[model samples]
Target: MRAFLRVAAPLLVLSAPAFGQGGPSPALIGRGRILATAADCVACHTVEGQPAFAGGKAIATPFGTIHAPNITPDRETGIGAWSDAEFLRALHDGVGRAGEQLYPAFPYVQYTRLSDADVLAIKAYLFSLPPVRRTAPANDMLFPFGYRPLLRVWKWINFTPGRFAPEPGRGGEYNRGRYLAEALGHCNECHTPRTLTQGLDMSRNLAGGIVEGWQAFNITPDPVSGIGRWSREDIVTYLSSGRLPGRAVAGGPMGEVVGHSLRFLPREDLSAIAAYLEGQKPLRNPGDTAPRSGYGRPDPDRLSFSLGGNGLPTGRGLYVAACASCHGLDGRGTASVPGRPGFPGLVGNSALGAARADNAVLAIIHGVPARGGRGESFMPAFGAASRIGNALDDAQIALVANYVRAQFGNAAGSPVDATSVRRLRLENGGRSPLVVGVWAGMALIAGLAILFAARLVRRRARGNGAERMP
Candidate 1:
């Protein structure tokens, strides 16, 4: 703790310029509020019943789980006493107030590009809030992830890439819009696809990716596959209201985003986001439509459960006894979560995409939450609070895993056995919290900003040619 204080004390002295420039008045606070609207910082940083900005929210990932830390004014546990300079380091340099490296999950890569003034305005607003004395919960990670220092290595590879900004020749609104979407907002945290190393796949910028167990549909302008069908007006309506009359409704994590953050943004900002998004390169088929093996769209009433000697018997028995109550006998999932057209039938649902069974294996091993667009908050996490509590052992877990694979028709072609499940359980034992997601509503706004930019450029060139024709 003494070391931490040493790291932070120097920073406390340097940041007075940024935070104090705004006069710390209510009017300045209002300006900061406008900047805050662009960033959507509160959604991930604050939890309900908790002081605003005093983090401790949980988020899930493919590897394990992670928790956001406290950013409040508590001198001991939170950043309460942090200086403006220190706060800037945390945002732009991925360093904490105490000079320790912060995890990339905090999105410093995106924040690094923020204009100095904008960062200061945000800092002023945050400092103005009433200090909340709350400490953040610890994150639960496996071996390397548990070691926070290792994050520096991840930054070495990924963070070295660069920050987001528009080309020099771009329009002012487009550039400002880019700053709002990429820098402060860090929208890529959910929208951009990731590489196997878990780094953001910048090549596919905003093409859409899966997050929190739901398919984050592509917002690109691909006519057949993306949201190219929606007009700019259609885009603003959805982001501001969380629903369009005929297009779609928000589901999963998106509902929370619209509920908490996007709605508060200025109408102009919404339009800019919409314009920028619509202008992105259109993907041919931008969705996770791959079906799991062995099962085609199953007819609930006439579905067959024959194993054909390919599945594990032990797992089949376990499912009948344990999961059938809520998930249904044929895995049709009853009326409770009738599920989406392409997503129903766990035996064949695409999340069980590959036949390897690791994904499905883990879900049954540990309870998967609010998956496949079924937003019921009914299911409970079983990691730390299971009745049997890791009782299945390895072989049993593997058998159950294999049973699901064969039963669900996953074609990854790898066999899951009790051995695999035991290994995963042991490996994941130290991990923290499960995940959950939202109500009925559609999320987003349409912005064909890029496409419009291209058209404007073409028009300008044509006019120049006409003038030169004399």
Candidate 2:
């Protein structure tokens, strides 16, 4: 009996880690893969033409560029040597294997809300990937801002480390949606506006912000500026297919997001996200206003216009040359027959109707492709070095964009200048300069405080010496 007990105990000990609560079963690994997809890990980690998850993609932030590290299981170059506890700390506490503070560019602030089981599941899936030995580029940040220790201060001021707690009395769907939206999906990272300190402003959660030159439109419940008017099905369709007939089409970064992440999500998950967004507190910015109606009616005079009228650059001439064939000189889209898919209408469209002209300009600069599950209705690119249509200069793109906004969108005389177009083109799309001047100002103040403290200490030392001299 004693011999049997000893053998049985050793066997149990050997098998314990595999069957434990955080064990790496096939089901757990599969779940982790789905969660990682929802998190869009590949969008930031996988560089073009590189091995998957080798992680050399450069992510631009207001402070500077941060290169994502290899998360593969390579012992030296990846996370192969990391323990489960270490990985959890990295996700939940934003600490690295060597105890270095990870930059917020990794979105650990949002990831901190994930449960231990979720974190371990992710680790399990990552460990399953083939290890690649490629090293990532070093981060390119400005002086003092590049200091890793400075993150301690940022975390203390901005971070609240805790797993998501389901709100009492809420239905399971709502709670599940909250977990997916707030933690796994990290939707607020793009949609929410940032404070002066570069932290997300919770009061205006999902109220929208510009990310990488594309506007992440408001997803809150406000009728004017948000998706309050959209039904749950509308949200689901947009998430699943990236477009909603007459309303708006996803382009730029959002196109990538839908193509890579949301489209692959199950219908149940998409429904939950819609439910959660619908239940959010309504928030409206000061300039919120509805789209003007009756702007897309046909204009007889402009219908027969020729390209390059009077041999000078005019918005009308450009639109006639570049856009008239598809969108029609009337500004109403072609192929509007019932039961047939049609090009998006220019008038009263959310992309055009929004107070900001950025989306409209962006569509012109970087053409919207057929995405999500929506069938082909491709728009050729006109921006510089475009592969499809003739590459239009910044001025030409601006002219056409402004014309559409005024003539069709009823956003007449809205400001979208050549200079702004040039900047957006040059920057490869814009991020808010939220951290630029603020960090410099803080550094100056910190230096002054240090100098003041040193002076005070010197004065006190001199006073003590005088008192001791008798």
Candidate 3:
């Protein structure tokens, strides 16, 4: 470890100057690479199991799927040919490969606040990689909305990209936090709600918004619906442990962000993150107060994973022993928050109620994530905590699995037995889950073709009628 650091130190000092005056330092680039990981840049840009920067990753969205672009230095296809000025322009201004307007889906609005040096460093590190000569798939946009010019309207209403302007009186940490939240970290990308035209509704920044299918919960200081319940220490601990005392483990995209991203962030940046998160507005829930019907509360004190005649118990004994404290014997969750937009009611979570049962069990088996939209790398992974390192016996996993399902709200009558949980655990063991995208482009093309054919048929019928009349 000492030797590697020694080599890095000199390499940075020697190569950093090559960046030209105000260019970039090798050390800065190196640091940026680490920050990029902390930002989980690759999680979206590079699909799981693929080599880095060879883009083919899919992101789900309400409009359609947006694929991450190639980040390598390939001259013909990647950014190899781009100059330092062009690079800065792209990040600071949100322009595309040909200076075309880029959609907000790229999150450049968040990146606009990054320092010129930080942006250059990240670009340099990206350039240092082995170029992957792959072209990104064309964005699947709906008609009258597909062209690049449409973004002019999007920008007119939503975007205000530029370097962050921190308050002079604020401390260094607060300033740093502001920079990250506004620019590179883009906490609001997920947290802020969007309008019908798909522009960000800035009025409700950090108030929790939905993107694709997943919801990015409000990170504000609201006591009822926000992170106001968490102390600064609690936020830090969750960032480190992926588990909170009263709250659950971060899950979904948040898990990938932590395992692959936040693990590399500097301690100071992480601290800055906590500081910023601690200052958001409290959650102001608006809606129909009645809880969604059908999911009934579990009978407390009844802890059995019986499968009719069989006892295929999974994770039961473990939950009773380990999780029964704050969560209570029943998985009913808290009265006001047990089930809501962001805080999914465990008893009746759709993921838990999944017909296959694997998704729900896996969340418990792996751990729930705290991945809401505003930031990346805030969640942590706990696969080891469960001791499922191919180290624990199958029976152990099953005991806890059944325990959570039955205790939570798998069904009003049916219990998720050990056999169900064991089957799921074995099926998904050791595999990294892939993010899926909705391909609306295919549907759009099909619709166009059908329209074309209908026109042709109508023209032929009119000619035939004219000949018959003559």
Candidate 4:
């Protein structure tokens, strides 16, 4: 599961009594298809290599794994039985077929802002797909989160079921962009930091947050920390194709979003999204001195990869052995045709230039997956057993991350240690110490309460027996 989906899973769990047997119009179904794509429906609803929207992907969280439910109109196990009203309620109110509260992992909090017509159109499009009879495995949520009814309290505190309202005097482009980004794309759900309860903190919208150990860098208009310097075209190109040469390249969850959703949208709609983001409030993150991609320069003379007596590779040696081919010895990318895409360069690359070395470390561990469009791009994984070569250990990854950052990123003085790499390696699903502590405390309390109740029951039984004997 993507980091964003870690907080949100089992989204669009639509079901209810079937609507009339009459089929919807072809035009409506086509329109619904586009709307669903805009909303990135298939990404969550379908498991890879499975029937689209058949939904059996296990979404992992701190609580447990949530398997995405079938939404392929299967009469027995999917949304084929769902009425239009039921579908609308699921998206807009976070309610399931039997009036059960849907988990926040579904992002109904943002989906609620979708207009009724749009919501129905998505349902129509889903119903048009071929029905698969596979039932999703049951969710394995732990303790309190598994209790669906308790979501009532979460909704009460965080949710507001309402349709999107366009700002008065705002141009069509801005309003349309806002609607797509907020209601459909749900951008802030990942980009914005979460509250203690795991709800989106609107106050820091697009200021950037970590997802799956990768930084979902700030998209706000702040000049120092965000994309304020990026032209509207840069935004469009990056969103549509997932890379911007020397500036940025989509990785991790954001990469998935581009590959699955953004590239499919028409150029005009992408432009609208860019225009809207350009006008957002500029908020600077603490300690951000310049743009993440503003540091590092190509220097061919810096290459030095000497090995020690123990045959251990130094940081530079590891990078040279693993990365020098694609990202050149000079930290510039390998050369390609004049107008064709080439390997992404290390100098001024966002991943290497961030304050924290999490993204850099993770990229080395997981490797960048191949992305389609604008020519194929990929990196080999060195984690566990390497696909291309010997697997890099945790200490090696930390060394590489630090070396890459010092040579190509904004933070030369600050380095990521092996312990941080180990944490990201073992538990990169955003489980902070505070969250673990809270869970531990709750478990302890529950155990103590159970013990107290058992002791009380034993005492009561003994007293009753004594009274009977008398």
Model 3 stretches with alpha carbons more than 4 Å out = 1-18, 21-25, 287-303, 306-470
RMSD to the hidden true structure, all candidates: 16.2, 7.3, 11.1, 6.7
Between prediction 2 and prediction 4, the one with superior TM-score is: 4
Off by over 4 Å in 2: 1-23, 291-302, 306-310, 324-329, 334-342, 369-375, 426-442, 446-470
1-470: candidate 3 lDDT, tens digit per residue: 11222221211222333275865556666666764665567878887677787787766555545677888889987789988888888887889768798767787777776666667767878987899889988766545446677577578777787766666676666666555555656778877887755667777878867543344566777654566756777767666545453354545655565666654555566676777777555556574122212233654565553342355333654555445443455665443233332233356443333223444445555555444433322212223453333333445554554555445534432345566555544434311122112224544664588679999999999999999994
Question: If ranked by lDDT, best first, what sequence of candidates would result?
Answer: 4, 2, 1, 3
- lDDT tens string, model 2, 1-470? 11211111111112223225755777656666777887788888899789888998988776677899999999999899999899999999999999999998898999998877667777888988899998999988866768888789789888899977887877767777787788878899899998877888888899998676667888898877788888999999999888776677788778878877888877887887898899899988776666323234444555555446457757878888888777767766788466555676676667777666777787887788766344457677788575555688888878787777776665553668888787666445223344456666777786688679999999999999999996
lDDT of each: 0.58, 0.76, 0.58, 0.78
Give the TM-scores of the predictions, in the order they appear. Answer: 0.59, 0.85, 0.64, 0.86
For lDDT, the strongest prediction is: 4
What lDDT would candidate 4 get against the real structure? 0.78
Span of ten consecutive residues with least summed lDDT in model 3: 1-10
Clashes per model (N, Cα, C within 3 A): 24, 1, 31, 2
Please tell me which model should have the higher lDDT, number 2 or number 3: 2
lDDT of 1 by residue, 432-453 (tens): 2331111001001112453577
Clashing pairs in 4: 8-105, 9-105
Better of 3 and 4 by lDDT: 4
Residue 125 accuracy (lDDT) in model 4: 80
